[model samples]
Structure formats: C-alpha cells, structure tokens
Target: MTLRVLGIDFGTTYSSMATLDPVSGRATVLRNAEGEEKTPSLVYFGADGTLVGTPAQNIMLEDEEEAAWVFMAPKRYLGDGDFVRALPDGRVVTAVDAVAAILTKLREDAEALHFGGPVGPVVLTCPASFGPSARDALREAAARAGLGDVRLVEEPVAAGHAGLRDQGQRLGNVVLVYDLGGGTFDAAVLRRVEDGYRVVVAPRGLDRCGGEDFDRSVYRWFDGAAREEHGRSFDASDGSFNSPVLRACRMAKEALSSKPKVTLRGVLAGQRHKQDLDQATLEGLIDERIAATVRLSKDLADAADRRGHAIEHVLLIGGSSRIPLVTRQIVEALTEPRGLPEPLRLGATDFAVAMGAVYALVALDDMAPSAGSPWRVRAPGTVFRDVDAPWCPEMVVLPRGRFQMGSPEDEPGRSNDEGPRHWVEIGYDLAIGTCAVSFAEWDAYAPRGSERYHPFDHGWGRDDRPVINVSYEDVQHYLDWVNDRLGLTGREDRYRLPSEAEWEYACRGGRETPFWWGGSITRRQANYSGDYTNAVKWLGEYFKRTVAVRNFVPNPFGLYQTHGNVLEWCEDTWHKDYIGVLTDGSALVKKSSPIRILRGGSWNDDSRNLRSASRNWFPSATRLSWIGFRVARTLIS
Candidate 1:
C-alpha cells in the first residue's frame, strides 16, 4: 500500500496543502470548506476565544479594538520566538502556537476530506534560506496540529519536483530555484540524482523583502500624490484610512502587473484622492528593492563558486516573481558574456510554488522505499565515473551541418526574439563534453588537490548534473587547469565558447519549428512553464530554481536538456547587431566590449523565450543561478 503523504507550503501570505490520492495516482490539493485551494496564513482570536480567517479579516473592519487578537503575518516571526500579545485581555500567545492553530484548522479540513481518517505522514516545505531553528519551529507546529512523522523539504525543491512531475519528466542537476514570497525571498541550487534530489547550496535573501514591500511602495506613491493634491498627507497614524487605502493600493499594484497603468479614486482625510499610476512610476518606486533582489541573487551565485560549483539556470517562483521590473533586473544582473537563454519564459507568478508542491508529493511517494526510515533512499549506483585528469584535452564537438535556425514566419505564439529568420552552415566539426561537466570534474582539477575537495556549503548539485554558478574567468581557469594537468599549453584560442550561430544551430536540430520537437509547446516537451494540461498543471509546477541537466528531453544533436534545464554560456561578446555581422560560423569574440553571451532557456523561463533565436547577454564577470555554460572544441581535421 502506498503511504499517503501530505505536502504543505506554509507561505508567509498564504498556505496550501496537498495529499497523495491512491485511487487517482495523483496528488490532490486539500480545499477548505469554502472550496479555496489555500487558506490565508492569518489567525484571529476573539474576546470569547473564537478563531477565524476570512471572518477575522471582515470583523477587523468593524471592531478594530476587538480585532486586536488578529495576527496576519505570524509566519514571518516563526523562529524569532516572538509572541503576539492580545490587547485589553493582555494574553500572550507564542508565534508557534498561533501557527499551530492555523495548521490545526487545516488539519481538520484535510481530515474532513479524508473521511475522518489520519492523513498519514506529512511533508512540510519551508524557505531555502531557513536554518535548523526555523525548520524545527515548523515541525513543532505540525506536531501541535496532530501530525506525526514530519519531514522537511525546501520550498524551491518542492516546487522543482512539482514542475518535473507535472511534465512527466525527471528532475535535473544545476537547477536554480527562486522563491519570492510575501515577506521573504530565497534562491537555491539543486541537483537531481537517479533516485532523488540534493541541495547544492542554500542562499539567503532579505527576510523583510518581497511583494509586501512592493505594495508598500505603491501605497507610499499614492500617499505622496495625495499630499501633493490636498496639501496634507493622509493620516494612517489613527488607522482610520489604513485598511481601505491598503486594499486599494494592492489592487492597483496587481492591475499594473498586466495593464500599463491603474487609476485609484478614494476619499482620504475627507478629500477625494484620484490618481493615475503608470507602470514606469510604480517601477520607479520599487526600483531599489528590485535592484536589491538582483544583487542578492548574484552575490549568492558568486558565493556558490567559493564552494567550487557553477550556476547553470535560474528558476523564478512565488507571486512576486511576476513583476516585470524584477524580472528585467535579474536578467540584466545575471546575463553573462556566454550566451544565456531568454529570461522570462516561465509561468504566471502566483501558482508556480503550489504546482511544484503537488509534483513533489507524487515524486516522494514514488521513490519511497517499502519500509525503514521513510525519509532516506538507497542509491542505485555511483553517480560518478573517472574521467581523464583535469586539464586533459577532452573536446565538445559540434557537427558541421545545417539546421532550421528560426521559427517559421507564421508560427503561433511566437515572440520578437524568434523572428527575422536566417540560416548558415558550420564548415568545421567541434568536440564537446559527452555530458555536462560535473562538480566531481571540477574537484578532480581543483588547484589545491583532493584534500580541498570536501563539499563546500555554497556549491550545489551532484556529479551528474551540469555544473553552474561559475564565472567566465572561472570557466577559463577550469579550462586552464585541464590543459595544465594534460601537459598542454593554455593557449587562448584552443578552448572557447561556441558561436551564437552554433548554439542556435545545435538547439534547432535541423527543424524550423519553435521548439526542438516542432509542435506547439506543452509541459511534457520541456521543463518550463507550470504544467498547463495535467492536474499538476492546475497546481502550478514550474520550479523557482534550476533542475538537473538531464531532467527533460534533449535536442536531436544528442545534447541533453538544451531547452529548459540551465542557460549555457558561449564565447562571444554581446552585440544587439551580431546577427547582422555573422558571415562566418565562428563567434565574434574579438569585440572591444567585455560582455559575453548566454544560451539555452532555463527551467524558470517561459516557452516564448526558449525559442531557438532568442538572445540574452551579460557582462563576463556577472554570475547568477540561471547562467551556466558548455564548451565546444574545433575538431582536428
């Protein structure tokens, strides 16, 4: 019998649960009595000890004093040991207890759906940046909720598993998982093994950052506008205009996400405050916060290298990941000299994590051993095989051939990057890795030797996945190490990036279709966009980070996961007009500018940006989770 497991994502703004349904071979999200897929991670205690959610939010409007027991963002204080003190009644309640009450209610709802039977073991998901103490707090809360046998999984990992299950694909290595929640932001690097997943590194984020900050920026904008119009700022000190004003501000922010501008009309301080807020204005307000996120992501990627690993792809998850400005900033900060996959190819922001959770539940059950510790799994075989010593002359070879390089002129759902079709031929053959180089490969060549090969905390992924989070200088150094070990001169032109033409040529596989497989994109064809056709589809499965390199189908060139695993780097400097300048098959590597090219759409990307012709470029020194590279060698003819 399959032991059912409950998966919970205890988000700061909202919480959701899913359980494996044996009858369906699928995971079902447990809905509340109101038929909601998630419950607000909010708790309210009345003077009479009554608890509520939607009701509490509503009651807080009429009786602010009585609503003193209401706690909206208690999850944010989980490990801080903070407590909410109820006013008037002066009752002290621990954050853990408050969270427990919310979980207890969810447990009741799950029990009701299960016909009063125990739901079995529980799998709880937390932020990747969470430490042991934060995880312990969540476990304690689950225990109070009457759940036994709890196991902890990182939020991004759960989402990545969910994404893989949704597409019916296995997970991959060097996967980047970006989780931006209501109150916090986290990004992680993960690798997929034959049996399960392992975290390569856990990067921290601004605990006080996220969608709420964006909302506040919007609110502050409106407040500034109100002051300019009425000659007086709206009073939030008394809290009279707080709730309605905040609601209006939130709606406006959501509207600006899709629409260019939003209009807000309301009465504040007895004066009608009406204003039209455009995307530019809102983005300007939150630009600093967005830039901060990008910086944090890059710093984390750089830190990953200290541990001796590279980042290949970046997965964007959580509701806040949808902001256009946020996406653009991350792309700009992470884009490198090597060509990278297009940046914005993933799914809608709101559902990625929830969808990923469902996929994770199913995958865990499928991999669980018959008996013993439900948490651990036995490895099928050694993931590594001895390769030639580092600095050895191993080459990545691209065949001299012609392939359809762009989508057809009339292709449906096509984007600007996929157009202006043209083709060329590579007159020479090249040698490349039979598979992406792994951490083990790098360890074999580390200058300090094997004694220094002990696992580094920041370097992520297993030996089988493509190594990621490496810099242009780092890649060059690795190549140098390889050459030195093999007793070869570290010549400049001997090892280099494949030309942009080579990257697209390989990705297209002689086809003119939008994707390597030719037909319209579906989740099964690649590891991008949340599943749109399956139940896991409805649950939202695109990971917020990277996956293993072999998690999905490879292009016809015998390349693995060319489309949506991690963005591979190429040798050319970035030029918007490089396509016009390409008369030969080689990259324009001698440009005066210092930037580099990145190729291949990553797991976080949407389908549109994953097309064969999409282009992305960044400074050579910039490093990010989604940016990783593969090598190409000129064949000795």
Candidate 2:
C-alpha cells in the first residue's frame, strides 16, 4: 500500500489534521486526544513535565501563573526570540521547537491511528501572508518532528481547493483566499493552473488583528467599565492583572456569537466583578478590525488585477470565519470592488485549510512520479510530459537511435537537399512537442495585443493552432523565457530547436521512408495541401491554410503534423546538402549565412514538398505564415 498523506494545518492558534487517501480521493479530519476536530496550539513546560494541546490548555485554566510558562500561539514568534521559553532543565525552546513538538505529537497520534503506516507524507499549511523566512521556519519545524516528507502550501490556496474541488472545472481561474485566524490575517489571490494553484498576487496580511484581538477588544471594554465602577484604574504594567480578564473575555467572545448577551466575571484584588457583554456592543468594538481585514483583501485583489491577475472567486477560511460579521464584510468587500462573481462560501471553514493541504498532496502526486523529479510527468499512451513548465506544449519522448538522414537518389519526389542518404546518430533522447507550439502557449508568455510583443497572429484560429508569423529571433526570445522558467534545476540549457539530424530522426519516427506511414500522403493523414499526391493517385483535400494541430494522424513516435502543417525551424544554419554535416547528429552552424534550416513541409507546400526528406531554409529574421517551430527538450540524464 502507498503511504498515506496527512495534511497538517499548523495554524497560529489552533492546529488540525486531515488524512488523505490520495488514490481514493477521500479526506477525513482526524481528532486530537480530546476527541475534538481542533487542538489549541499551546505547549506547556513546568515542574510536572511537558504537555500540549488540551492538557496544556487545561493547566492554563487552573491558574493564571501556571499558564505563564505555557507557550500559546507560537506561530507569531517564529521569526523572533523574544518569546523563547526556558525549561526547568535550562534547555531553551524557540517558537520553532514549540511548533515541532506539537507536530511530533500530532504525528504520533496520526500514526497510532495508522494513517496507513508508521510514516506518511505531510503537507503543512501556512498563512499566505507569511514571507520567505517565516515560511522557511515552518519547514524547519516540520523537519524537527521526524515526520515523512513535508510539503508546504498557503492556507488560502488550500482553502480554495477545499471549496472548489467539487466544481470540476472552472470558468475563470483566479481565486482569492480570505483567511482571518486567531492570531493572523491573510488575503491572497491564487490562480488555478494545470496541476495546482500559483500565487499570482502576494498576500497582504497583519501579524496581528485576529480573533485574539477581538477578545482583547472585549476585555478592554470590560476593564474600563469595571475601573469606572470601582472609581480607580487597573495597573497596565502588571501582566497578571490582565491575564484573568483576557481568559474570561475569550470565552465571553465565543459565547456572544451565539447569545445576545453574556455576563463575564473576574476577580480584582479579592473582589468579584461581573460585566454584562452584549453581542451588539461586541460587534461594535471589533467592527473596525473586521473592516480592516476586509480592506486588506480588496487591496491585495486590486494589486493582483493591476498585475494582470484577476480574482474570479473568493474562498473564506479560518476559525474566525465562524463570526457572521467577518464573513459578511468579506463578501461585500470582495464582490463589489471589481464586480467579480460572488465568492464561494467554504463548507466546514475550520477544516478547509487542512483538507486543502491534502488536495495539494494529491496534485503533487499527479505531477511528480518520484520525490526528486517533480517537473516531469510519466503517463501511459504518450511520451514523457513536462507538467511543471507553464504554457508547456504536449511532447513525446524519442529515444536515441541511428537513423538514415535524407533520401536515396532514386526515390520519388526527392529534392537535391535530400540526396546522399547518410547515417546520423542521435545520442540523447528528445522530448519533441506533439504539435507546433500554439498561439495560446506563445501568448501566455507574450500576448499579441501589446505593441512591444508582436508578431501578432493573422486572425487565424488562435487556440491549439500553431502560432505563425514568428521569426527565428522571436523563437529565440520564447526559448529564453522557457529556459528562465526552468530555473536553477539545471534544466535551463536543455531546450533548443532540434538539430537538423535530430529533427529528421524524430520526423521519421523509426521508419525509413518518404513519410512515416509509407510513401503516400493523403488529406486524412495531415493538414497540408494534398491535391498533388502523384505518388498515390487520389485527389486529396486542400485546407487552403493551417488547421488545428493534431486533426490528423500522429507519427509512430506519437508526434502529430510531422509531414505537414507548418514547416519547423531547426538549429542548424543553411546547408545545401548532407556532404559536410556532422555524423553525430549535431547542428551545423555557419556564420556566413543569415538563414537557418526549415524542415517538415508546411500546409501550403505541394505534396512533393511534403515528403519527410524535403528541406528548405529562410533568413533568420524572416516571418512567414507557413513557418512555426516546435520545441525539443534535451532529456536530463
């Protein structure tokens, strides 16, 4: 059996877990020791020993002084050491350790429940508002837990998956996550890409301004009222003086959400003090905080829109969303500002983050065959695929082989460039695009409407059709962009126009013939002008121009349009014949000619010109309707 995946929402104030059977697509929230779905993110260290979750919380309620040594909401202290606590044995624990301890406990419990074995991959969720350092600390903490491989995902992005999983497909891809937690607030815009969500908009957030702040608001109101009744003010410098009120107010706040009013009692200098807290008054006190959180969401969404990332839906996540005011304000702020469609209200708001993390694991599993090579996707019925490259075209993997290049002198429809049938060896496997690179793929990196980025499409079918009117120089720019996107994985330099021999070997698809499927070309076999098929006697259809790629049969290597469609550019410079070409399948670069080799005749070419052996060349800067190139990725061994 595959190791189970558990999503850990190691939140600021509360932590939750969800076990995912990725293959089955089932996710269930796992309860903590107290049989509750959520556990307080508190850790206690005292003379009695270390304790966590409900037990740590239980000691806090025993006495204000006992809770002082207990760490609560350690997530806020991730970056700083101000909150570091010293154990009785003189060992110190930082925020990271406290978090690790919590996770270790959660892991032990989950494994006891057999989250299918002694170990499983864990996906940890964090607020999107967390920056690189803060997020990095989260990973470090999980590492300390001795858990399985850990993956990180933003809290809001996780919530978006949790809310939208059943929607099947989306009309618009961008989603905004509005997360207001117990100790932090985050608003982020995530774009749903092929396998997972991409953080298009950096999240906006406050280190504070959470449910705990609301508790403080109610506490302050009660303290002011009690002080006025006593005709004296409570000392603010004494931390102990406020601890009791803070604890009572937190409970009162939760109660006020359901009750019209709740009476909170606290002892001040040996006297019992009671204050009546009303829902209306509590709402008034925290209204500004709620509005500020809403403003942050709109501001982040607006910033994303300015950067060309539009918000299509808003996903609400966090324990604080149980508050009606928070949800109502978020709805109004996100929906009206840009008239985006109404946000999807998340079901089971508390578990959304954890559930979303499980979904993230599933996505990672689909995209990656192993832990190390995540960018590659291994699937049946086709060659290897590059799932990570944005705007990546479908590609087929062709293994190394020795193929005879060019055509025999006696072959029908042979050009002079096709003579001297010579052997060329391709040493490395290639990932060739299944079709010519489309306009949609090109526009993803560079849109046509911009004056700076054109070689615009000539009003031909844009979707799935090869992007034409692009010069050799334009393809170079696009390749540069693709390589940059490949990043420090050292896969950057592995993509280029196929060398002429490599192109020939791939187009032949392991066959030595005029075409991959025997010498005869037909309209049903490709998108080219097939009327002049003298080799076969049948009058074929004339498409007039390029049609949607792959409308015809694919070659033996699972590559489409290898015989016709658009003539593809090769890396080699112009060569009149195969006389001086390298025998090892490298492209021949000549500094003298401004032209490069073009192969696999276009849809506008005659049948004789559509032969696999036919070849042509044009100046490097030439842009023509019948010319578009496919990308070939060098397999990184």
Best model per lDDT: 2
Please give the lDDT score for candidate 2: 0.74
Q: Can you give the TM-score per candidate against the true fold?
A: 0.55, 0.57
Over the full model, what C-alpha lDDT does candidate 1 score relative to the true structure? Answer: 0.62
Candidate 2, residues 1-637, lDDT tens digits: the string is 2556788888877899997655666677998767888988989977777788988878777766676678778898875646677664576779998898899888887877645357666778876556444655777888898864776666766776676664544526777778878888876666666756555544456667788888878888888888888865443344433655787888898886678889999877777789888878988998988898888788778756654668777777776766778767866767866676655556678888898777766654343335563322111112322322237555666656888899988778777887678988886546677778888888887875764355555677787788888888899888887665543123533567888888888888899878898878777777666466434545466777888775676776667788888999999998888887799977899888899999888888877777888899999998999999998876542
- Candidate lDDT values, in order: 0.62, 0.74
Model 2, TM vs. native: 0.57
Best by TM-score: 2
What are the runs in model 2 whose C-alpha is more than 4 Å off? 22-24, 81-83, 87-91, 166-173, 191-199, 231-244, 304-310, 337-343, 364-637
Q: Which ten residues in a row have the lowest lDDT in candidate 1?
A: 377-386
